[model samples]
Structure formats: C-alpha cells, structure tokens
Target: MEMVAAAATKDAKRNGGTPEWRVTVPEGASVTVEHERCLAARAWGWLVSCVVALGAKVSGSGKRLWKIGADDPRRAVHGLKVGLALSLVSVFYYTRPLYEGVGGNAMWAIMTVVVVFEYTVGGCVYKGFNRAAATVSAGAIALGVHWVAVHAGGELEPFIRSGSVFLLASIATFSRFIPTVKARFDYGVTIFILTYSLVAVSGYRVEALLVMAQSRVCTIAIGIFMCLAVCVLVCPVWAGQELHRLTARNMDKLAGAVEACVKDYFADQPADGKQPPSDKAEGYKCVLNSKASEDSQANLARWEPAHGRFGFRHPYEQYKSVGAAMRHCAYCVEALSGCARSEIQAPHHIKQRLAGGCASVAARCALALREASSSVAAMKTSWALDLAVAEMNTAVQELQSDLRSLPSKLVEEESPAAVLDAVQLFTVTSLLIEVSTRIESVVDAVDTLASLAGFRSSDVEKDEASETETKVKQPAASDPDSYEPEKKHIEQV
Candidate 1:
C-alpha cells in the first residue's frame, strides 16, 4: 500500500494529475490500495465513535452529550478531553510489549480517569489528588491486614479474613463523619471500603494478591495523572475568575435596581411624575437575586486553587462578608419599598424638597455602586466606594434632622387616623435613614474584596478630599427648601 501511494504521487507530479488507477489483483482476492485506505479510515472513525461513547458514559456526560450549542461547549470540551485521556492511557498499556496482560484489564485506571475529570481544572485537580491519596492509603492498609490474616493459621485464617472486611467497613464509615475528614478526605473512606474488600475477600481465591494490589494502584495512579494533565493543560476554565466576573455583573444589576427604585420612590411628589408602588419595589428583586448567584460562584471559587492574584481561596472567603453587606442593602430596599406602599401627605411645599433630596442621594449611591462594580471587575481599589459611604452617611444625617422637624408626633395621643399623614412621613424618613446607613457598608465590603483580590492602596487609591467635595455638593442651608421647607406649615395648638 505504501509503495502504491508513493508511485501514484510520483505519477501525479509528472503528469500534472494522477493517471488512470489500476488495481493489482491477487488471483481471486481483488485487494486494491484504495479499498485498503477506505477500510482503514472507516475503522479509525468507528474506533473514535466507540471511545467517545465509552468516555461519555463513564464521565456522566452521556446525558448531556447532545446539548451542543453555546451553553454546551464546556461539556463538549470536558468529554473530548476525557475521551482523549482514556485513549492515551489505553495506548500506553497496549503498545508496551512488557505490559501485555498487565495492561489488558486496567479498569481501575479507566475508572479513575472517568471519576476525576470535572468541568473546572481546579475541581479535577482536587478530586484527582484525593482519589490517588485514598487509593494508596486503603491499598496499603488492605495489604497489611491480608498479611496479618494469612499468618493467623489455617483454622482461624478464614474467620480473620472475613472479619477484616466488616472491621474495615466500620472504621471507614465512622471516620467519614469527622469534620476534617468530611471536609477534605471524605472520598477516602469510600475508597478504603472498596480497596479493603477487594484485597481481603478476593485474596483468599487469588494467590497473586500482592500483584493484583500493585496493578490496581498503578492503574489508578495512571488514570489520575492523565486526567490532571488534560484538565490542567487544555484550555482550563477557572472558578475564581468566573466568580469575580459574576459578582461584578450582579453589582451592575444592583445599581440599575437602585436607580429605578429611587426614581419611582420619589416620582410625582406634588411635582411632575407618575409611578406605581409596584415599580418602587422592583429594584429589591435584583438585590435579592444577586444573593443566589454570589453564593454559587463563591462556593465554586472555594474549590478553585489560588488563582491569579488571589491567595489560596482568599477570594472565596471574602464573599461571606460581602454577601452579608448585599443582604443588608436588600433589606433596606425592602423597608423603603414598604414606605413607598403607603400614601403619605406632607406640606405641599416640602414634598418637592424631600423628594429632590432622596432622588439626588439615590443617584449618588447608584453611581458609587457602579464604580464599586467596576473596581471589582478590574480587581483594583475603588476610592469611589469610600466616597459613596460618606455621601450615604451625610444623607442619613439630613433625613434624621428632617424627621425631627416634622409637626405632630407619629406616636400620637390624638386619633390614630388623625396623625396618619405624620406617621407616613415619619415612616418614609426612618426608611430613608436606614437605607442610607446600610448603603454605607457596601463600599467597605467591596473595598475589602478588592484588597483580598490583591489590589493595593496605590491602585485606584482613595482620597480624603471627598468629604470637602461632598459638602460642596450638598444643598445650601438657606435655600427655601433647605432642611425644613414646611417649618411655617407646621400645625400648632
């Protein structure tokens, strides 16, 4: 076949194209080069399909194999890598003359590859190391127990060997409940049970117990190595990087939510606007939904090794505090929404002032949130977050003063319905103060995250001049709407 191909290539070069093909017949067996090449290609194609099928089945990707689209590329890459790794291990075993029968039944190695391969490289590495450690520890223990049972004499040997399985099972089961073991070596217990059963129970029948044990361990190790190599070396997907981006996206969503909520909250306050109560509460959903996304990515990021600039799972740990801050912000929004639900009539002149103040503060807070989001996305310090915190504090103080200047007490001695308007105004003031206070922590949370992600002070550093700048931006104290536009409108005895 090689000679025929070479001769055909030479003819094609000389004549500018291939001459008419002729097949040399072997009497009754008409075997042609073309037929041989076609058969070879078909066999190769069939082998690939079979391997892919087996790999998909083993790695649990069989169910998702047909989900081929933008969302399914990760699975496809994982399955392809798994199939390739399995084939490589098989090749090493089959081609080596000395491996002959030793490599023929390397199911242990195959199983290791199948079980350790995960979507993320970090997950694969973690599982691979855990599996290898468990297999070795369990195999060693099994071999030791088998030796002890063997020397226990002919009469008691069977009993001791049988009891060893139960004993090992009990220990393995109990050890798995330990916090440290459950956290790190949970899989090891399962491995201990299987390894011990195989070595102790099957050792009696199989005289080559030691050889079987050695082969099993070797195959498992090979499988783990192959899986780790492919998962790490081939276009690896990182959980930490994904988490960072997800958090940033969520922050952006939160900004939009706040912007919308504030716009609705203050709309048409005897001014020019028309928004429903439901519209005011819509922003809270984004903040609430953000919690779930933040949680999932944080958990996955924990499994990821120290990635990029993050130190050994540092980025994952910060999520707890950051998530807490976000939850607090969500609660504030909920409270504000509650206030928005109640219709509150205040002095007509002061209504515009209150609404304007809240709208301005909300806009500032949203801007800060957006800046924090960008800082997290960029993995740098955000002085803008700190600036937002100060603005919220100032707003809270202003709201408190406004609350104190209101006429009739919200906790009225008069008819409850008579002071309903005062109570509503009080509720709005209190909710606004709470929202401002809660928003103050968001910048700190984001800043802490930035530091943990390894962004230094020099990188997007903050300035103390923001306080002076914020004061400058504050509404003048003598303005008609300043502090108490309704001071003269207060109903007195």
Candidate 2:
C-alpha cells in the first residue's frame, strides 16, 4: 500500500500537480484506514459515477433525483441489497411452503420499501434511526393498549386504554428531546418499540404472536439499517451551514445601517450660508431609518436562521448578539438626531443690531438671521449630541459581546431575570454611546457655524466690555424741568 501510494504521488507530481494525496498508517493502530473507510469511499464514488452516466443518457431527466434517507442513493441501494440477502435467508429458514401464500409475502414487500425509504432520507445513518423507531414504537403502544382493553372485557372502554396509548405516542413524538439528555437516544426508541410490541402481543395466541412480532421487528430493524446506508451514501448536508449563512446575512444588514449613518453625516452639501429647510428633516429621517434597520438586524439574529432537520433544537446565539449591537447603533442615531433638532435659530434683531462685526451681512441685505448670542448656545447643544453618539457606539459593541455569550451561558433552568439583565445592559450601553456621538456631531456643526459667524466664546467678553463703557457714559436726567419741557415741547409740536 505504501509503495502504491508513493507511485501515485510521483505520477501526480509528474502531471504538473503537487503531491497532495498520501496514505499512511498511524502508530499503535491495529485497524487500517482502508478497511474502515473503504465501504464509504467505494459506495459514494460508484453512486456518483452511476448518476453522472445516467444523467448523460437521460439528458436532464435526472435533475431532481429522489433523495433517499439523507444518504446517497448508492448507500441506500447497498442497504437494500443487504436487506434482500437477509430476507432470503430468513425466508428459507423460517417459512413453510403452505404458509408462503399467507401474510408473509405482503408483509415482506411493505416492510422492505418502508425500511429502505426511511433509512435513505431520515438522517438515521449519522445519528440513529430514532424517528422511524419512535413512530413504530408509538404504533406498537397503540396496538397494545387496544389489546389490553379488549382482554379486560372492557372493549368499549376505549377511554381506559386511550391514556396509555396517547402517553406513549407523545413520548415517542418528543423522543427527540432524549437526544439532548443523552446523545444516543436511538436505543430509547428501540426499547420503546420492543416494550410496546411485548405488551400488545401478551394475550395473543402463538401463531398471532409470531406473525405480529416478526412483522414489527422486521420493519423497524430493516428501516434502521436502510436509513443508515442512505445517509452514508449522501454528501451529508449540514444544518449548521444554513444557520451560519443566515447569521451572516443579518450581520451584513446591520453593518449597512452603520455605513449609511456615516455617509449621511459626512456627505457634502451646498455651502451657502443659508441653511436649507429640508436639512434638519432629512437628518432626522436618516436617524429614524438607522434605528429601524438596526432593530431588524437584531431581531433576525435572535430568531436565528431556521432551516434543516435539526434547526428547531439548535439555538443560534451569535445572531442574537449581532441584533444587540444593532440596537446600540439605533440609540446613537436617536441621540444625534435629537441634538441636531434642539438648536434654536438666532434672533434676527440681534443680527440687525450688531451690524459691523457679527451681523453686518444680514443687516445690509435685510435677511433673516440668528441672534449672535444664540450661536454660542447652539455650539453647546451640538457638543452634548456628539458626546451621546460616541457613547452609543461603544455601548453597541459591548452589548454585541454580551449577546454572543448568551447561547453558551444560558441554561434551561436559569432565571429569566438573568437573561433580561444582560440584554438591558447591552441596550442601555448602546443608547448612551449613540447619544454621545450625536451630541458631538451637533456640537461640531453648531460650533463651525458659530465660528463662521464670528461668534466665538471670546466674543462674550467683548460684548461685556462694550456694555460697561456705554453704562459709564450714560447719566440719569434728574431735572424735572428738563423732563417737563421735553414733554410740553413734544405736545406743542
């Protein structure tokens, strides 16, 4: 085997390919890889080849070939071949010529097809034939309950036996849960079937017992092997892959929302001194959209990407974490939008009165303008918004981490409060971060406008000085005569 492998490696290298393939026996190992893996390799390879050949002959006729028991058809075929061999042996030893025309023929035919189909598609191979066994077990229980009620001379007492039958059925149905409790739950299903069959055949005569027991065992056992063979033959599609894709898609959407926020904040706009009427509205709308978009992503994460056979039992925790992050992003948008909108327009009179240094352009053109002092006020508002936006972003990242931890940390018996606490922390953290960033942006915009208008914090000092000088020059008119004359003169005029 080593020589053959070496020769193959040389041929592969000669054909302009790297020697990527090799065969080796591990140290202290009694079994060879060839013995353990040979059946699988041969079966899968042959099946693929057969399918290709069949497709070539049929010209697209085999596009939607029937999928047998999560297994490749070839594996299922192998199982059927084995089953047929066993059936022939059993028939030869267990049957008489006189009884051949009775129920045996029909039972074998039905059992064969069912067993083959179940094994091929039900994922019975990788795990065990639990589902098939569970169903059969439930059926057997129902039959037993019926028999017990009849034997008790309470044939009309369907109610008495109904409880046991239904309970067994429910147990069988939920046997999927047993896999969680114990990795090998298939044995439970088998035991359940056997027990139920034993109960149902308890009062039956020998002939009836033989027929029913033989049929039930044959169907269940055959089904189990057939499903295993089927799964082995197929490529074994993973449920986890679909879950991951869904998780990624949701995360991408969340990322897109963040990108949109960046673009909206940094995008260039008309540089005219006059603020556009729609500017505030557009900014606010973008903030709202960002919030909603983030929320959706978070929801997608929590629900997980549901697909495949085992998805119901699989908890997708990562998706939930992404969602928490998105919420933080939304909170940040809110803070930013709120700060941007809180800015008060400066009074036009202030612009008109301070004509030379601050409001000169507005006064000259008779244009609407903000009060000079209001510019400084707006700056402070923007600063607050910016701070909030920054905080919200930080919170989102934190919350995402917390959410990611949930799937691994959460236990079946854990208190709901624990989960809620984690979620709330992430949410609150994101909200604070968002609020900080938004405040910062608003502050920045306000400050820029203030600077552009020559309304700096230092300007307040200048205004105070000018006010002092004017007060010193002004004097109170203490003369009543002067005031009386001014009033009389105004009246006469």
Candidate 3:
C-alpha cells in the first residue's frame, strides 16, 4: 500500500493523466482527470495531425528548405520531415488509451517507441530526459500535497497554497542537484518549473494530471530529438565555428590591407621625404582612408561573434588604434612630400645633383604607388607593414648615424637647423626631439595595430638619441663660392 501510494505521488508530480490510487482520500473515493490541460489528449491529437499534414503538404517543396535565401536548404527540409514524423508517433502513443486499456501492453509500446525516438534524434541523451523528469517531479509533488490536504480535511485553497510554495522551493533546491545529474542536463530546472505551473492551475487527480503531463513531455522530447537527429545525421550547423571562420577570414583581409599600406608608404616619395607631384600626398591619403575603413570593418567582424556568443566586451581600443595609426601615416606622408618638393625645386646652380639621386627618389615614390595599389591591399596584412616600418626606422637611424659622423656644421646644414638662428636652432632641435618622440610613439602604435590584426613584431629596438653631439662635415668648408678670394690668393697654388 505504501509502495502504491509512493508511486501515485511520483506519477502526480509528473502531471500524469488519470492515476488510480488504491488509497482513497476522505473528500473523494476516486478521481480521474487530465494532467496537463494545455496538451491533453484532445488537443495533442489535433496538434500532431496538423504538424504531419503540414509536413506532408511541403514534403518536396523546396520552399521549406530555403525559407530565406541563405545557405543549405536541405537541412531545413530534413528538420521538417523528422519533426513531422516524431509528432505523428507521439500522437499515436498519447491517443492509444482512446482505443485500448491505459495500463495494458499498448501504453508500454507507446512509451518505448517515444523514448527510442527521442534518444536517436537528440544528441544529448541525458539532457533530453530532463524535461520528462521535471514534469514527473512536479506532478508527484502536487499529488502528495493534494492527498495530504484531503487526508487532513484541509480546503482546496490551503492545498493550493501549500503546493505552490513547495513546488517553487523544490525547483530552487533541486536546481543544485540538476547540475550533478549530467553534464548537459541544465535545462531540467525549467522543465519542473513549467510542469508545476501547469499542474497547480489545473484541479485534477495526481494520476490523471501526471498522465497528461507525461504525454506532453513525450511529445516535446520527440520534437527536440527529431531536430537534433536531423542536424547530426545530415549536415549540422555550428554557429561558433562559422563565427570563428568569419572572424579569421576578415582578419586575413585586414592583414592584406596593412601590407599594402606599408609597402605603399615605402614606395611613395612623399612619405619618406621624396617627391613627384603635389597631388601624390592627396592620393596617398585616399588609399590610407580606404584601407583604414576596411581594417575597421574586419576588426568589428572579429569581435561580433565574441561579443554575441560569449558576451565578451567589444574591442573599441583596436578601432581607435588603427584610426590613429592611419592618421599618423597620413601626416608623415605629407611631411615627406613637402621635403621632396623642396629637393626638386632647389636651384641647380646652388649644388650639382648626385648621380641617380633624382631616379632614386622617383623609384621610391613609384614603389609606394605600386604597394598601395597591388601588393598590400588590406589592413589584414599588418605583419608585412610592420616589417616595412621596422626597416624604414632602421634606414632612418642609419642615415642619422651617417649624418652625425660628419662635422657639426654639416649636421646643421643637412637638417632644418641650418636656416635657424642660434635660439631658433635650439628651439628647432628641441622640436625635432619632440617630433622624434612622436615618431617613436607612432611606431609603438603601429606595433599595436599589427598585434590587433593578429601579427607579431620583430625584435628590433630604436636606440635612444644620444645627448652628445657628433662631428659633421660643413658644406661651407668645401664651398668654392663661400671662399674669401684674398685668403685663397695669398695661399696660391
């Protein structure tokens, strides 16, 4: 009798329909009613038939697969077919009692068919069972409360109040235990809550209520399993993997852009103080803008999945860094353009041009054009740009070293310092130092930009500028035009 009562209690929590308990309550000798009113036999039967009919109607209709003009139409059709089949099977099992006895071999066959279908379709065997477990637990708890109320001669209102409080508390308490049930059984928590909510509102015998709940739960499990089975047996879609691939592809494109920008910088005369036309700087600016824009998009695309799937914070710093680096490159290109124009327009009488000097400048400018246009087309190629930038910095340092080896006068003449007064020279030198500081800062920014685009930096360091001055070769010392005729005449050859 105790075992029978316990089984009845368990069945009630499941929202089982029409349970027959041996022990009768004081208020009622026996009770028979549907458990889950929402999906009782009448409603379940219609819903199942409707789903099957819909599936049959659209069996080979390509429209079902390509609901939207997206990829993989077959997967959708497969899901529909499996879902329809599962629904039909579930309806058959639930409605079996209409034609046959409830506790007979027919009910057992229905349960077996439903469970087998669920396991085969669904990937996670244990998680699939949580829904059923929750319904059963809820129904059992509700039934126990009702039995106690009737046995103690309590009113329906008190019974409901007690049942609601217990169900809510049970869900909360059992949530801790659900995690331990299986790795994928996290959804079990929701199943019980939903089942209890439905049962409490419907006044019925525990057995009847559990039967209805079980039927509903079986149907749900079938649907879920069908979807899973179709996806696994056919070509499954993985959002995480797709998102990751998209991010990687965009990064590659951005890397290409970076390479193009870097190569262009080196080839462009304006960037490194060589010159061609006045419009070159403007052209370079446009290229930089386009590449920067592309890189921005790629960077955002990389973060989309991270933020969407895992709730990671959006990378605003990367966007700002790329923007700032592009701007700095623009400024450098403009400055180089101005220097190149100065070299070109200088009076030929003042100094003879060195062999191939003009051609070298032109070649540099041409290289920049080609790189910006072809080799490095996207910011994704940041690694190549980083290498180029490092090379440029090295070349600049070498040039500075060569300039220092000459006399102090030569240093003043070679740099912008030649035109400045003593105070101005000091000020200009300080300004140059400040500018150099900015140059290094821009280099670091470039490195960071490359890193964000998934590139590594080489082990090259820009040694700090020395405070001590080096000797320089003065141009005036060797200039025939600047020689005093009397002094040279006295020392006649």
Candidate 4:
C-alpha cells in the first residue's frame, strides 16, 4: 500500500493534477463493507420509523375526528345537511335550463349557501335575510346611480358614481357602529357595503348593469331560500332552545358549585396533615366563561320564530339578565374556592363551630337555585321557589348571627397565626353570605323570565290544587256538625 501511494503521488506531480492515493485492504475489506452496510441499515430503519410515526399520527387524528362526530351525531347531520344544500344549489350549474335561467350569475347562489348556511336554523335565517335584503337594496340603489351617471354624460358620470359609493358606503359603515345596528344588522350593513361597492364600481364600464344586478339578486335569493329550507325543514336546532337550555344548565352548575365549596371547606383533613389535592370543580368555572356564549345565543335566538314552547315575542333578553346574576354568584363562588385552598386555613374547631350554620345557608341557596333551574328547564313557574328563597334568607340570617358571635372566639386565640386563620375563615363565610344574597337576584330574574315568557304552573302546584279539592269535597266526616254544614253548603250550590 505504501509503494502504490508513492507511485500515485509521483504520477499526479508529473500530470500537474491532484494526488490520488489508492490502497488494497485485503484483510479488512469485509469489515469496511460491513460498516457501510450498517450505516445503510440505520438510514432505512430511520425512514421506516418516520413513516410509522406519521401513520400513527394520522390514525390518531382520524380516530379523534370520528369520536367527535360520534359524540354529537347532530354535528354529522349538520355536515350532511350542508353538503345536501350545496349539491342542490349546484344543479344550476349542471343543468342547461337552470344555467340559462340565471346565466353565469348562478355562482352567487352557491356562494350564498356557502356563507349563509349555519348549524342552527335561527342563524341561517338571520344571515340569509340579511344577505337577501342587503343585495336587493344595494342593487336598486346601484342601478339608480348608474342611470343618473349615464345621463349626466362621460366627464361628470365618474364623479357622480364615485360620490354615491363614498356617501352610501360611509353611511352604512357608520351605522354598524351603533349598538342596535351592530347587534342585529351589522352583517346586513357589511353586505350592503360590499354589494354597493361592487355594483357601483363595475357600473362605470359595464353596459348592462341592470341585467347583471338582476341576475345576481335572483341567484342570491335562490341561495337564501335553499339555506332557509334546509335549515328549517331538516334537523333544525333552534337558538331559543339552545339559549334556554344553556341558561338552565348554568343555574344547575352554579348550585353545585355553591354546595361543593361549602362542603369542601368543612371537610376533614387527611391524617398525614398534607393539604388535600385540589379538586376544584369546573362547574362554576364554566359559569365564569359563559357570558359571551349567553350574549351570542340570546342574539341568535331573537331571530328565531315561534317554536316549541317559545312564543314569537318571547323575552329572550331576560335570559341575559339571568346569566348576569349567575356570573355574579359565580364570582363569589370562585373567591370562596380560593379561600378554601388558601395557605392559612382556619383551625379545625373553628371550622366545626361555623360549619353547621354555613352548611345550612349553602344548602338553602343551592336548593333555591335548583328550583329556579327546574323552573327554567320545565318552562313552568316553580311553586316552591318563593318558599325556597325564604328558607335561604332565614339560613343567611342564622349564618350572620353566627358570624357576629365569632369575634369573641377569635379574640380568645393567643397565637397570631390562629387569628389569621380565623380571618381567612371569616372571609370564606362572608363570601358564602354574599353568594346567598346574590342567589335571590338569580331567582328574581328567573321569576321575571317566567312571567314574561308565560310559563305554566308547575306540576307541584297542580298536585297541591288537586289535594285541596279532594279535601274540600271529602267534608269533615269525623265531626257531624261540620259534615252537616258542608253538606248543606254543597246542596245549596
């Protein structure tokens, strides 16, 4: 190998090129080949691993999607409904007759379906109506502007058209900032601006502006109609029902959080003396984040027509009131939860001393909340709601009395740490009291909703009425004098 290398170097110098050295490794030849083979094997292994990992990720994603569809079959149904609507609208492009009817503007109908179709019927109706009305109004204004600009001749025509677009667009955009308009007709205003701008700008060059506007409006109307039909006729999810159900569910969750916070605060510590694992219930947390959902649902619900158990003019606004009250109570609950998990915990005996009163207040409050929830869910006035609120108030008073007597106990404690713990205990108690008080607001809101919505009397009221009637008809059989009076009264009637 040395001799061959020296010869190659001399040959490269004579040729005026780079040196090239070659060696024969007869003994290590198989090992060198084996090393190369090992590297190749590793590369192949890595490639296989990467492919396997990708396949696994894809499979997992697919399973998650399948699980989501399975969990709420309604989502799957909604997807199918959208596909069906699009397919039905697509016929305008596929069939010659339909194509001739709307011309190439049939694309507008497809676009409308894509943009307007929603999971809930109310949402679809809301967007569809806004789009259709905006298109027609904008188109009419556009055509009139175009006609005037054309008659004004070439030089002044451009200014007239530009000025109209700027004025109308600015007015429409400014209207969107208003509260009422922003809430309900914001989408309409946006559509109006888009339609007006498109038509107005295009009219500068297009000769047949009227025919184009007409075709587009007709196509959009067809799209809107298809969306409404599918949304209403198929598995329609009513926004009102969703809002109603969501409000009731939040009340139930609030009740659970109140009761759980009180119970957890008074619960016994483990023997090991370590703080128990934090088991914060998510129920009240959900209430804390529910404001936006409530607002959107209420807004969408207003667009919904009269449906099962809901009147055409049902007081959907009242639901927001109920939600506001709930969120307030939920804030207090969240504070109590933090107090429960605070580093300075009240002494066990102090907790014991206040436990009964606090538990009673919490229980009564939870009971009242549950009654209100049941009222909303059943769409009926709760017969026992007033009684429940009264009991809750009484419990609150008792808790207050207990709190008034707590200072003496705290004063007796010699250790400052013990006093601090008592202060924490008082904080928790005060929050509970505040929560109990706010629960009344929640109940009142529900009562107002029940009255405005014209909810029927609950089953409990009917049962009580039937019981009273039976008692009245039975007469006083044990007392002959009362029986004769009752019999005489009945005969007279």
Please tell me which predicted candidate would have the highest TM-score against the true structure: 4
How do the predictions measure up, each by TM-score? 0.66, 0.30, 0.34, 0.85
Task: Write candidate 3's Cα lDDT for 1-493 as tens digits.
Answer: 7888888888877876656567556543233333445458768899999999899878756665565435756455645655654555455446756324333223432443343332122322333456557656877876665556556664565666456767696755576675444334455666566566666656343446556655555555454455445444555343323323433333233323323333333333453454444333344355345544444343333322232232344343444454454455445444444433443333222122121222232333333322322221232333444444454445445434533443355345565443232332222222222333343454465345444545322222111122122223333566776567867897996
In candidate 3 the C-alpha lDDT for residue 347 amounts to 27
Question: What local lDDT does model 3 show for residue 185?
Answer: 46
Predicted model with the maximum lDDT: 4
TM-score of 2: 0.30
- Model 2, which residues run further than 4 Å from truth? 1-130, 143-147, 154-210, 264-493
Per-residue lDDT of model 2, residues 1-493, tens digit only? 7787888888888988766565666754645655668878999999999999987978654443444434455555655655554554345236676235344533543353343332223223323344455546555555656556666775544455555646664766577566443434544565565456444445243336545555555544544554445444544333344333433343233333333333322223334423333342233233334434443333232322334322443433333343344344445544433322323322223212221211121121111111211333332222333343344445445545654555346444455555543443334334434433433333344345444433335456667899999977765477466477679989999
Candidate order by TM-score, highest to lowest?
A: 4, 1, 3, 2
Tell me which of candidates 2 and 4 scores higher on lDDT: 4
Best-to-worst lDDT order: 4, 1, 3, 2
Residue 398, candidate 2: alpha-carbon lDDT: 50
Residue-by-residue lDDT tens digits, candidate 1, 1-493 = 8888788788888988856455776754455766788899999999999999999787776445455635657766877888888887776556766266455547667778888888777567667777777778777877787788779877887898888788879988999999877756676678768777877788788888788878888788888888878877887787677667766765676666666665655555533333355543575666676666665556555666665676684767686676678678877776666555445544344444466666666777677777877777777775566777677667656756655654444334444554444555556656656656666687778777776667765332444466678888998878767646467567441
Cα-based lDDT for every prediction: 0.69, 0.43, 0.44, 0.88
Can you give the lDDT of residue 394 in candidate 1? 75
Cα lDDT of candidate 1 equals: 0.69
Cα deviation of 143, candidate 3, in Å? 4.1
lDDT of 4 by residue, 118-178 (tens): 9988789889989988999999999999989999999999899899989998899999999
